[model samples]
Target: MAKQEAKFDLYVFHRSYFCGKMMAYMRYKQIPCNTIYATLDKHGSDIASNTGLRQMPCVRTPEEQWLQDTTPMMDWFEERFPQAPVVPTDPVVGFLTRLLEDYADEWMWRPSIYYRWHTKEDRTLYKKLFVDELLGGFWAIGGPVSWLAGKLVHRHQEEKFLSGDGLTKANRKHVEAVYINTLDRLETIFQKQPYLLGSHPSLADFGFFGSMFWHFSNDPTSNRIMQERAPGVYEWVARLWNATSTKLGEVKFDYVVGQVPEGWEPLLRDACEAYLPYLSENAQHFEKGSKRFDWNVQGFLYPGVHVSPYRVWCRERLQGFLNALSESDQNRVREILEPMGGWKPLTSNAHIQSNWDPEGIAPLCKPQKLPLMYKLKSRFTGSNHVRTRRAWMKD
Candidate 1:
């Protein structure tokens, strides 16, 4: 008899965008995994105890190791299961794919959050969904208690997403406009090819699955817009969601190495034009000890956006990846990015701290400055020895 394969334990909720992305990726790769729903009332404590953080879409490896952060998780899994490579082999194409993935991961978050929680229709719908998923049948106990709990959850998310620095009336139009533009561009791509890169799904496709599948395709208002305006993209979301080994096996392996499809250029250009500038400005402000910063993209002003050290770290990671590429590969990528205004930021001489922590539990926008004593101690004992107790505690 053959030995049974060990299945990965995934801690997630059905309606979470990040979780959807992870699910799509794992299913596409034909990885054996089982879902463990992290309900707010029942399983929330289990997740917190396991990871020391409340974030969802965490993975417990076959070896009993816990992992978070979708990007790193994807990388780790790819190394372990090298049969289906989501990352492109060509350096230039790989760099571009990573850029798109990063843009989808960070920049698209604003619109995703806004479209999900800002509108009354969406708020009412998701409140029920959240309550049902988190509390299960607890609403049967008492109407008032269930209603109050649902209302509190809705209000908290509304304040965080709609009223907070993430989304406001001033920038709402800009965010929606960006989303529409992205959908239009993506529709064109899906019309030409099944996936972003080609026949086979890549990191770019899964990156988009995070927002498009869970929020835009699931939320009532956004789903209507997606179905009406960009049915191609909506269908693509469904396809990614239901992807499996059998389905993926039917796709011909026809993706040419080092070739990016023409449809992707416009979307990539928009990312470079809008998100790159925002990231560049945010990094500058973060380094200067500013807690809040903002920037304008395509004549739309976004004011009072909080400085995120985590995002700065993301930018630095991308730049570091570019810098590490061979000169020929760098030049090749520059040719692709230069016309879109991305080359400068991608190759910027910005000072990135070497000792910065990439822990997911770190405060999203808080400065990651080390105390003088800790900094001095790190020099002698190596930076890894520096304690991140305060950072974890902040979350």
Candidate 2:
């Protein structure tokens, strides 16, 4: 039988890293797809609300089925299009690639968005005029609509920030410093080779590229810093999106970890270090059973710096996940970073019953859990509470 015809359209934001990641993948594989620009307030106008997550990077399959999130899209793509594989054939490379991709989606995205909107004064730097241009015809459908839509989104962001969930003065500094540190380290790695996994661009490269291209490259404040401090990394981001990487022989895949050029290892270590705080903070929050963060807040925050039940559970999960990996997979992770003292594995301070030691700020009393703006009325059955804030637009 013939291969099935391409199915589905993409609902995306031009500046969404998640959207960009999927788009780059679709482009690389030469998949045929329709594109829709789903701006913030216009969400109700699209099928995104019908889907569980009210988010972009959603896919509408040829069957007219809607799917959301990067991981699910990738899973669908891998099964449907197997000719040009984004996953590596080698197990070690594959595992590491998945880990890096996860890190980018979760840990990196929060701060990246913060820097895009809050870290800078200029709003035009990151807005994509092309997004409106692409949907120019839609304006006829609703001319003043886009302007109103943009205002709603801006208001939404402001309200979320003021809700006092994600961003705090300390966390902002922590995120800013780590964001720069991550780039500095990543730049060194790109300097060594074209892609993170070396010679060949893999799934991980696409994910990281999404974060870099969608946010840093588009935002004025971060973009300027990127060019000034990490020109090579910026160049690599552009290269991956190039139409040519998909075609064979334009770029060869021969880079191996040990064979990588000098100065790359240190950069990676620093990136890893920068990543730890967010990871630790999330784990702590989960354990404390605290809804300290607003679902819409753009960064990580924890009232207490010390180890909490959340951190203990998080560390346990990490250990279990690591233990489940095949020996060879574990060895590969160790080998790649052997130059940087290898994988020491993170420990839970709570489990050890040690005093809390946060990476930044002076020690303080264990803080109280912030009340959630709204709580899930029913656990796991998909129920939530509606909050009453003065500015909250009642639905």
Candidate 3:
């Protein structure tokens, strides 16, 4: 068979979390993809016209098909182009990979955004790039207009991410500790192996890689911390980027079939302990039809954070993965999770079906454009909510 070319046009800002994740994934797969900056002024209308919301990392395929949401997009890619598969065939391994991916996708987002906006050095540089993405297409580039746009964007991020989500002077140190713990765990894993799974960069690696490669490794403050503390993890970022699917055949994928890598236990522990409970809380709020709810992860409270219908969908997906397992595999997986206090949240609610997107159309869908006047329901809308509030009609 000829080497297939899957050329895709990607709309993304260089510093975006999911954008970097998708880019890294494409590079590893050796897919023909081009990165097009999805700046607010230039591609804002294009994004609004194409996908569910004004979000970055939207994909336009060679066939002119539009895709949003990395989780489903990657799964679609794995099915459409099965060359050098990243998802393992072993049922246990595959299930664990999806669980880890879901955790990385939904949970790590808070700390990832926090590092970019909360830390002074990272914020100083990132704020300017952010303003340009939002207002650069306008007539005046840098004076008073730029200043105001920056102010609004910065304040919105600080509120929505830093304060709104939950950051108290009391729990601030604890939040930083969560990020550091991840770095230390990943650093240890990288020190032992080339990737999170085995020889190949599995879904687990790509899931974490989106935030690690984009925000932590590149931003000034977090980058410095990663360099000083987790050098191995920093190096793995580049290693995974440099790897290609065709080249990975050189390494043998030797495993005991069902055993999760010992090195991955800490990451799984964190996901079970931290990520699952957070999902359960969000699911409760969505079930109650409440607009906002308290977030108490590991006993640290982030009260009154807005409820997310999207995350309820995420929790539902995780539950599906668990339920799809074979009876024996489920029992073994339960043994691993129950000790870590992970199993309850996944099974506590007998029925967890989020009616957010009932038609099963995601990544590929008919356009459903919301009125430009309406605020985007997704939290990671690049602060488009604030931008629309003031600069609704373009800067």
lDDT of 3 by residue, 132-243 (tens): 7644565227888767666667787888877887778767777788779989999988898888776888888888888898888998888988999999989999998888
List model 1 lDDT by residue over 183-251, tens digit each: 999999888877886678888889888999889998988899999999899889888777775666644
Error of 2 at 320 (Å): 8.2
Q: Itemize residue pairs with steric clashes in candidate 1.
A: none
How does each model score on TM-score? Answer: 0.86, 0.67, 0.91
Off by over 4 Å in 1: 135-142, 250-259, 354-395
Worst 10 residues of 3 by lDDT: 386-395
Off by over 4 Å in 2: 1-4, 40-45, 124-152, 158-166, 244-246, 249-252, 255-277, 293-324, 331-395
User: Which 10 consecutive residues of model 1 have the lowest summed lDDT?
Assistant: 377-386
Candidate 3 error regions (>4 Å): 1-6, 250-254, 375-395
Query: Model-by-model lDDT, in order?
Result: 0.74, 0.55, 0.76
Q: State, as a TM-score between 0 and 1, how close model 3 is to the true structure.
A: 0.91
Decide which is better by lDDT, 2 or 3.
3
Position 187, candidate 1: lDDT = 97
Predicted structure 3: clash tally? 0
TM-score for predicted model 1 compared with the true structure: 0.86
By TM-score, the better pick of 1 and 2 is 1
Q: What's the C-alpha lDDT at position 381 in model 2?
A: 11
The sequence of per-residue lDDT tens digits that candidate 2 reaches over residues 1-395 is 99977756887767677888888777777777888776533552344234433346777667555665575467567777776677665555555555566556655765676776574363443222422532233432445765643444444444343223355665677667657876887887788787775666777677677788878876778888899999988998887787434564443444453233244355446434544444555555555655553321234453433223423333444444556668876666667655443254343333432122222111111112223432222111111123111110111
Which residue pairs clash in candidate 2?
A: 8-62, 283-310, 287-310
